[model samples]
Target: MTRTTLALALAAALALAACDRGPANGAPAAAPTAGAPQAQAGQDAAAELDALYAEFWEESLRLNPLSATYIGDSRYNDQLPDTFSAEFRQRQLDFAQRWLERVRGYDVEQLEGQARLSYEIFVSSLEEQIEGERFPGWQQPLNQFYSFPSSFAMLGSGTGAQPFRTVADYDNWLARASNIPTLFDSAMANMREGMANGVVQPRVLVEKTLPQLDGLIKDDPEQTLFWRPIAEMPEDFPEAERDRLTEAYRSLIADTLMPAYRALRRFTAEEYLPAARDSHGLDALPDGEAWYAFNVRRITTTDLTPAQIHDIGLAEVERIHGEMRQVMQEVGFEGDLQAFFEYMTTDPAFTYESEEALLADYRAFEATVDARVGELFSLTPKAAFEIRPVEAFRAQSAAGGSYMRPSEDGSRPGIFYVNTYDLPTRKTWDRDALYLHEAIPGHHFQIALQQELEGIPTFRRFGGQTAYIEGWGLYAESLGRELGVYADPYTYFGRLQAELWRAIRLVVDTGLHSKGWIREQVIQYMKDNSATSDTEAVSETERYMAIPGQALAYKVGELKIKELRARAEAALGEAFDPRAFHAEVLGDGSLPLDVLEAKIDRWIAAQS
Candidate 1:
């Protein structure tokens, strides 16, 4: 995914609202001399600091209005500013620069605890944004992984970010939805620029976009997902206003939205596809190496090179495969690993009878796991969650399971979308581990609790690091045995399979983007090692292709958390409390892996 895609999604979830400081470019300035004016000012700066941060936050909310909307702040909802325009982008750049200067001038040493973290976060965020200006991300906005079209669909689907309860809610959406045409046009214009600049999406991804767009274009507006608000218009709405709005929506859907979607689809298929690159790597485009490097840093939150990540992936994949072989032996599969994988895939018992059965199975896993979470975790989220199948239009390409964080207002519960597009491929073996990772105490607990935090700055509560968030999710899967669900050998093997897939991602994501491995090679590698079906393997490989470096986060993060847990267990001896240890790791929301490690080390030392 592009930075904007991830940023927009993160913004929508209200996950990362804090400012982030960039790494210092040179030596730190010497500390203010004791009793100097700077030191004296620092001692009395808390009240001023609070005021500065509040101003910083209010300004930030205005700049990224979608973020304001997601947090239940309606002040900027009707203002669909042209974020894609050059003027707006420059304005954002200026905003970051100005804020960095404003915050950096403060006497950080005078600030205490949370205030210090707030200052660090804000400065880092500003620097990261300014540094990112070197990249031409706007030129390549439309990818199959996430684009304005897909994001708009999810919002208008009635079950997503857009609220449909109140008249103002309906109006908010009508205004938001009406801006789709301009965004769509901007996407087309950007893609054209991409074509001219040789920054276009891969041919494979553009082809995927066509079918997705086709799914969104329906003959009857009332039947479409976008038409949801009109159908559910609040009873409190004035009759004249409702009728006018309904007819206006119908005309907009039939005339503007549907045709624009179709036109984009046609343009991509007929015109863009022919010009799209056959090569899967972003490195094929201009400054592609720098671009991919930037993505690696953004997603992994580390300076590790692609080659380094590729090597780490290879090592983990081999290590996980050794464990899988033990599973093969336990099952008495008298064959090679490939044969065992095939057996696992084709076995009738591993298949769900239908999508409902699949969702039911996941829900049942949720209940089973929840009953035992007390054994492993002390902290839990107040927000509840449910299991639902991926919406049909996106199911074919969606992951096995993905979690959408709950709205800050708590009007919408967290949702874990399980892809049931191909039932058989949605194997029974995958259910237990997937549930532990996506629902209940995994993403739901960590993310929801973070949002509900009362004292932290808004940014830290909402902002996240991939290594911490995804790493926590992957680590949650490892809790299956302790939480009482990995009793069956098959289920235990599924847990291993989940880890193995993340490990393989570390390898394949790096290989495809950095090592120049072809798509088929990655698919064949997955098929040889794991029980995933060919169809599932292909879709996953393509997903990694579309969003380079993202897959690395899971394995990289899980390994660090696992490593830390092992250390805590070894050092604390009888004092190690899995519940407390889990709370410490999760209570701070998501942090850089190094920061998490440092905090845990402090905990361990304190206990000692």
Candidate 2:
């Protein structure tokens, strides 16, 4: 799941949530699994693969410092890669090419079970990275859903990954912060290139970014989020040093960061916004169809065509609507499904009394779900998690709830950020399903476990495939009933509504990108089929517009996991265990849907 989502949708609706277990899959409870023979030659091959992975990780960290900071690796805290630069893009291309060749030198067939799996995944990822170079992702760098400026504010706010524990940490951020001007310039240049190539973002999406930039650029440095570190500076620091740092930060914010933000804000408002495409679909641009197709392939990790996915979405929407009808009957609502949807969306009882009540309710879910988590999950992460609100600055566009993967060192607990901005709109009915999807036994459970894995390579541990990750979150939501949730009919309806939203995304995302659907069409689709508020519909549609083929992951991944579970239950009969099946699906970390399917098949065969 990414850091953001539509407020109507669960946060981290598209992120890393895995359910791994078994010694073969790096679970502590399982014995050492060696599917390869004890032949010396085979052992050497496996050892070599491990060595390659280690070296690759080391080099990768050096190249991508932001990734290092993200995982709580402070070694590169001072660095910020110029991610939008042509040089950086070329470097990425070169790294993939070199690694692809280096990895191919080893024979995957000669490797044992886990080693073979790692080798295969690494090879496939590198190949995809190489293949992906054809698409001009660098041209379309900024989206309200995912942008550098907002992320920069989070990093420098002293609350995100940039540790503010020591004096060195302060200095490290200063070094990192100094690069903002360069990054913004790079972005401006890239957007210009995008305009030239007819690859510019839709005008509506560009408009959403203006308010985000406005929030970042404040008149007084002390009033800015960048000043937060100084405000919360460690008391233990020598007064003289603290004083010196405070003055330095004041200058940095006013002189450097402000100008950078203003320059970008001005460019965006004056030039880029006007140049942005009026058309909504990716099909409007040159090679837009192919670009979207590549994205669909990367996102779903499947070769299913757009038409196939669109058809799948339509079927799923119909099915979920039928389930919603069941909920309507259970709730004894006098109206039709649409009327009930309108009632649920508009009802005052469904909303929290205040933001405090909203956050408190979300926090309370931890203990509630904790009591039942063990019934379905045999293993849980050692790294704990906490519930927090989405920062006010971005909350307008933020998802209902999102999960941040824990730091590898366990110092940074996974954060489940619930949006408390639009308090009245943040429905109580959504709380349970949102929690299950983004918190315990969902994003938090799957993503943290994947990071904490011992034997898996860093790529599989830290990197993720969207479909499997999001699918697991969606699948985890289905467990609410068995986990003692969805007990109330309205609550159960919320779960179905959540599922329906995802299915709708499958339709709308494909519709917007490939099937000639406009923004209004997508919004109307949500209003008709689900309990999505107008604000949620608009933002959610914009989110799909911003990132094509991404929203499809939730339903596609969930469907696959559910399909696997059903297959296991039917095949093994009395031998079927939900917990074990979950562990198997998540055990290998995130995989391409086909690879995940193959792995699940292997587990099913073993069970048989």
Candidate 3:
């Protein structure tokens, strides 16, 4: 997912409706009024901004209960309102519009620094949500990559963000789980509408989703993934509560969750699969080109068209391929670019002996990189992080690594899940760059530090821009050399491989949505361009298929950051300080690429 949707969708799914009293660091939450005296204005404005922010956050959670859950709030856990319903969807749109209007009326000039920027970001995001209603995203929600079936399997496995330790927890899920049948029925209806309207997913993607749903359907309640809560009910619960919750959960699983999954599975396999499109491009659907364009703007936060992004991707691919060729020469590989890719993939020396060794290697890189963080960054996060394998149920289709943000209360550490599904694809060469991007100095550092900022309003602290966030992640991959991993030629090749993967994403993501590339064609392009194994290639291709413009973020955002950085270094000549430059880039949290560039220009002018 692009950082916007990653944050916004997660916010939609996970943020809760709790009142924000203030900053978690003990600051009082309130914002100052306008036209106060200059001397006292700063303090008053800070307080006023805090109150406005707290209201915004509370309203946000209420509007998007799923977000509240992910942030660790239990207030709406038992309430699974039909988020896909037209009424609820309109309510969400109205919520965004009202909040945008309310916050805009507040005299932001009274606020200073981070608070002002936070206001802009909040307004921009809400406005973007309102604008995005034109696209029919709800019609095509369940894809192979991240449909509710797979998400629930991960949660019901007793290992995800969903908690099952209390009777309340069990009851919450029971209430939530009971709604699955309705959602499934709605999904089948929506897919029918899509098929009639010619907006169906590619046949290949629909085919892959059937098995995922089938795996979740069970004849017996105890055999179902959803039955885990009943199996592990807390011993301390009152007997009445335990007995009541256990029976309710069992019935919910047997009569509700499983049947819904089975029905959806059968419908996809028997009905939708036959009607699914052979064409891959979103542009082929009704208003598909416009939808793809909207996604591009939402993801990149720029007006650049699909064709523009396509050209940029082509240039980056060529540049990175040249670097890989140099790496081939360094390793004394005898043939062309594809030959070197083969050598890297087949070489036994680059493979991990076991999953334990793989995890150990990543942990070791974390320690090594942590030691050097102070050299580059002036700010750091208080939240801790851990490296874990992607949960097995979804790992087959998961990415190499991804970060889950920390709980608002810090009860849970941020998790960086690395998928080790196919051992050879999980190469030692890939680990260093992956570690930097998903862990230490990449997502965990950027997202967690933003969450920990004290004076910024809660929304700003929590909010993100995809370009800035993913741009930072891609930039983090470049730090492998300074962080000490790229000294080895093979490891350096890994960094290039990672970059190449992203570059290929730029090509294929646009190619699928705009240029009419078929599913196999996209998969073929990925396999030809990088050393990713067949399993990894399939997963990555499906990910791009699932989210139309998301994969564009990594390369698009990275290119903008790198371009700006080069400009800054050249303009400053001998006076440039990487540490200070990084501080400026990160200190304000995430911003649009244009906004980021403008801010950097101001910083450069001030330094000069």
Best by the lDDT measure: 2
Candidate 2 structure quality by residue, lDDT tens digits, 376-405? 889788889898888988888877778887
Task: Give stretches of model 1 more than 4 Å off.
Answer: 1-17, 20-43, 234-241
Number of the candidate with higher lDDT, 1 or 2: 2
Cα deviation of 569, candidate 1, in Å:
1.2
- Model 1 steric clash total: 16
Clashes of each: 16, 9, 19
Q: Which ten residues in a row have the lowest lDDT in candidate 3?
A: 10-19
Per-model TM-score, in order, reads 0.93, 0.94, 0.90
Please, what is the whole-model Cα lDDT of each candidate in the order they appear?
0.76, 0.81, 0.76
Give candidate 1's whole-model lDDT: 0.76
lDDT of 1 by residue, 1-608 (tens): 11211236321222234663222332232355676785455545555556666666777778776777665566776656666666767777776776676566566777765666667656766677678787676766766665567667777767666677766776777777677677667767877887898888788888887888888889988877788778777788889888887887888789878888888888888878998998988677788788788878877777789989888988888888888889888888898887878887899988999988887878777778878889888888888777778888877777888888777777778888888897888888898888888886678888888888777767777777777788888998898888888888888888999998998888888788877888889898888777888778988988887767788888788889999999999999998999999988987777777778888998899999
